[model samples]
Target: MAVTSVIASEASLFLTPQSIIFDEKSRSQAVHVVNRGNRTGVFAIRWIDHTMTEEGRLFTWKEPDKSPWSLQPYVRYSPRRVTLRPGESQLVRIALKKPYDQVPIGEYFSHLNVVMLNKNVEESIRQQEEGSEEAEAGVFRVVARTGISIPVLWRHTRDQPAAEVEISQWNSSQQTLSLQVKRLGQVSTRGFLHVIYQQNGKEKRLLDPHPLVIYPNIDGRKVNLSLANRALAGGKLYVYYSADKEHWDKPLGFASIQL
Candidate 1:
């Protein structure tokens, strides 16, 4: 009988300040990337543009040549590639090439992607080819190159937008809540969502700090959140959209529904 064993390897990378925002006052920004894995990590960084659907699905911008809303054209980054050892860190600096006024009065956004190279995977493959006894015993290895993308947005000085939240739909059987964040005014707004379940006299938080973004081109975004394994009978659900993840005291939008 041949015994099979599977080994999985992945890169451990951490990023600080999940999102980046640039306005007239700020000229540049920095993103910190740390390697938490024991092995050295090689990463490639670049800017990518994406469009969001009503259901909050991201797709690469199809019309790159005519994508007026893309922020890639005006933005620049440093250190396109880097090699980080364990407990090492690198800073990726971003700056705008064009003046703030030169841009149109709207929100432009793109994603900064940090992708891990498969150097470790190649090493593993080379080792397996050396013919160890464990390899003869049917040892299979699977390696993954993980990557992260963060939204980077730049808004004109005159562009200001407001957001409002509404409960679009609900499914009791599926324990799901659907919401639409409506955008009003010129620019777009990005923030986080918090869902609270109030039953009897006690309250339970169902969703804490989910990303919410409504671009300038779109009227609103549809977000569906699942509330599985949580008691929702005879309760009132409150949803709040806040400017940042740290504080919910002042919400940009608020909505509630009774079950």
Candidate 2:
């Protein structure tokens, strides 16, 4: 075999679409994972039970959520173990096992953890490769491989409407923008965040649509965005939060920075 240095880790894994949302009537859908690096990419897939902390961080636990919409038990995905050569891709199909009519209308959620395979083995391989080079040049050192993970989410809805959102508090200092989001209702909101500035009828967008999710059962989800100093320079900065861009164009909440 040809050796071109495996190094610490390979940038071989790529995930498309980023997230998944399944309606009550929908049965199954697919996600694509591609390998873009020179070496082979191996991965393992499993569902994790997690909840959003009051601080807006993810806390994963072995005990699943008791809600009817829990994605861990109902949604089944295939090809849990994936191995792909360079430039190759695989399809991971997901389907719901429970009957939609029987379940209550609410948002149940879980995460699909796509983890890179074999951390210890990869370290051994990298160490051996490094040692071989050191033997030729008479120098020795140890380097290890790094793991990569992509977060996938699944949601189920039953005639439940979209939730309302508001920015109860927002302020910026130096380069940091902080927000306290108030999410109303049992349904969670998943979408991208947009930061725009307008002055003299001209608009400047500091940040485009970036994925964000604020779950339920808390005072609210707190979040912060780091911006360049020029993002809010001499302009009216507007923070717009919205989902369903493909279906709706209006923002769910609008806020401006003061003090």
Candidate 3:
């Protein structure tokens, strides 16, 4: 009998705001997770209150309606157990609840934990007592710890207006796509351009550009997208933007051109 050693790679979780702006109503925050490991890993996370006092810092756990721990208010698990096969990565969505006119104007903090479950702990212990030929019984067990900080800012209302996106032009000869965007109001916007086309009622993504950052007051910025050697036979082109990658808005601007 041969034994294989199992080890966990460095795993981490982070929120875009690190600090967030919360209105009276409930608002959601986006979190990105990176799995830098050869095997799949699982994570368990919850939000705990961390209040800053004159002396130093005081931590309190919040218990929401339904969760794993009583002290933790909101607990979430990745929808599916993430299986990362050598350099694979994934993202998870988390929602933060803020009751109307409840929280005061200040900085609030919370913690998140990424854990890996041990699958071979019992087997390892049993093998050790049997005097197996293998020198060591190799132990695999679930590991968990808490060490992530989530900072949030409370505000009354949204300060800026939503952003607008459009597809300016499409060049079939050159196999390139051009995009133009206008800032309707003033809100720091970040999103990517996703081009989807339909053929025989079957939808497929034509080109996905890297997420672009649009600052306030920037009238129209052009993003060059390459669509070379792609199947664009008979389909309509659609372009749109989104605050979160998972959810995308309707086609603000579009053009029907053939390649």
Clashes of each: 0, 1, 6
**Which ranges of candidate 2 are over 4 A from the true structure?**
1-11, 65-69, 119-155, 158-178, 195-211, 217-219, 224-237, 244-249, 256-259
Which ranges of candidate 1 are over 4 A from the true structure?
A: 1-11, 119-144, 169-178, 196-210, 224-237, 257-259
Which candidate's TM-score is highest?
Answer: 1
What is the lDDT for 232 in model 3? 61
User: How many clashes would you count in candidate 1?
Assistant: 0
Q: Which ten residues in a row have the lowest lDDT in candidate 3?
A: 66-75
- Local accuracy of candidate 3 as per-residue lDDT tens digits, 112-152: 44344422334445667886564555645444453445543
Model 1 C-alpha lDDT per residue in residues 82-164, reported as the tens digit of each score:
88877789999999886666766777888898988753544556677886666678886675767988888888656565678
Assess the local accuracy of residue 8 in candidate 1 as a C-alpha lDDT between 0 and 100.
40
> Model 1: which residue pairs collide?
none
Angstrom error at residue 143, model 2: 9.7
Ranking by TM-score: 1, 2, 3
TM-score of each: 0.74, 0.67, 0.40
